[model samples]
Target: MFESPNELNIARKEHKHLSFSAGIYYCLGGQAAKLEIEVAFNCLCDKFKQPRLQEEPVWRKNSNMHGMEMLMIAI
Candidate 1:
């Protein structure tokens, strides 16, 4: 943000991008997605040791859709 008429904001500590956009383009599923991701990470950390990729991931052709077709993880 700029300081045209007010304050220019900056992070005082750590920073991370969540990608929860604003206005009409904002992701309506952002909260749910964040919750799911947190739960999944917790589960993985609790149940597994150091996880690693076992093979190259396969992806779909849909440009708007971002995900893996098959992910093989070795702990």
Candidate 2:
């Protein structure tokens, strides 16, 4: 709700271009999504002892998405 108009416009454009966009419905429930992600990450870290990175990740190219293609975790 506090976001600027320009930021929201950019987001709307990006969402339109993306194939997997979840739309404003997700934004309306962003708090719930953030909480779930936090809980899962915390639980995983707590349960895994001495969890370390095993390898460098190679990101996917020529794509609009910017997430890790491969994340090697040594647990």
Candidate 3:
């Protein structure tokens, strides 16, 4: 489980993620955020012929935040 949170394993049958909070504390912009991501990915797919990673992603060092610090991609 130590390594599980470091990667995007979409194929996992079950998982737990709390990025947008939950219940009464749920993020109001969660849906909007999802929509924005979807639109951005769609646009990238339409605009780029074959975009690929230019280098390995650098992940953030913050224990409180789990995300990439730099993700270079080549179009």
Candidate 4:
């Protein structure tokens, strides 16, 4: 969702490490993985009163990955 190069660049720099798995060929199951995660999260959220974060997570951006590296959530 970052619209500018500066924003994207800053997010990418917040992390100390990076990895990329798009090697010889692209992942054939990427969509399946995404769908699976979404379904699981939706079910959990529906059953919870309030999803609370344990702490603010580091936002890391790198090639093919952009998400919380460590997170704890409770209802």
Best prediction by lDDT: 3
Clash count, one per candidate: 0, 0, 0, 0
lDDT of 3 by residue, 1-25 (tens): 4356665443555534577888899
lDDT per residue, candidate 4, 1-75, as tens digits?
Answer: 334433323224433232224656656776687588779878877989777676665566764666656666767
Model 3 scores a C-alpha lDDT of 0.76
Would you estimate the TM-scores of all the predictions? 0.60, 0.50, 0.76, 0.49
C-alpha RMSD of candidate 4: 8.0
| After superposition, candidate 4 runs with Cα above 4 Å error | 1-24, 58-69
Which digits, one per residue and each the tens of the lDDT, describe model 2 over residues 1-75? 334422212124332332335666336656676588679768878999876668765566645665566767789
Give the per-residue Cα lDDT of candidate 1 at 19. 52
Clashing pairs in 3: none
Error of 1 at 47 (Å): 0.2
Error of 3 at 14 (Å): 4.9
Report residue 48 deviation for candidate 1 (angstroms). 0.9
Candidate 4: clashing pairs of residues: none
Model 2: lDDT of residue 50? 70
How many clashes would you count in candidate 3?
Answer: 0
Model 4 alpha-carbon miss at residue 38, Å: 0.4
Better of 1 and 2 by lDDT: 1
- Runs in model 3 deviating more than 4 A are 1-3, 8-15
Whole-model lDDT per candidate: 0.62, 0.56, 0.76, 0.58
Candidate order (TM-score): 3, 1, 2, 4
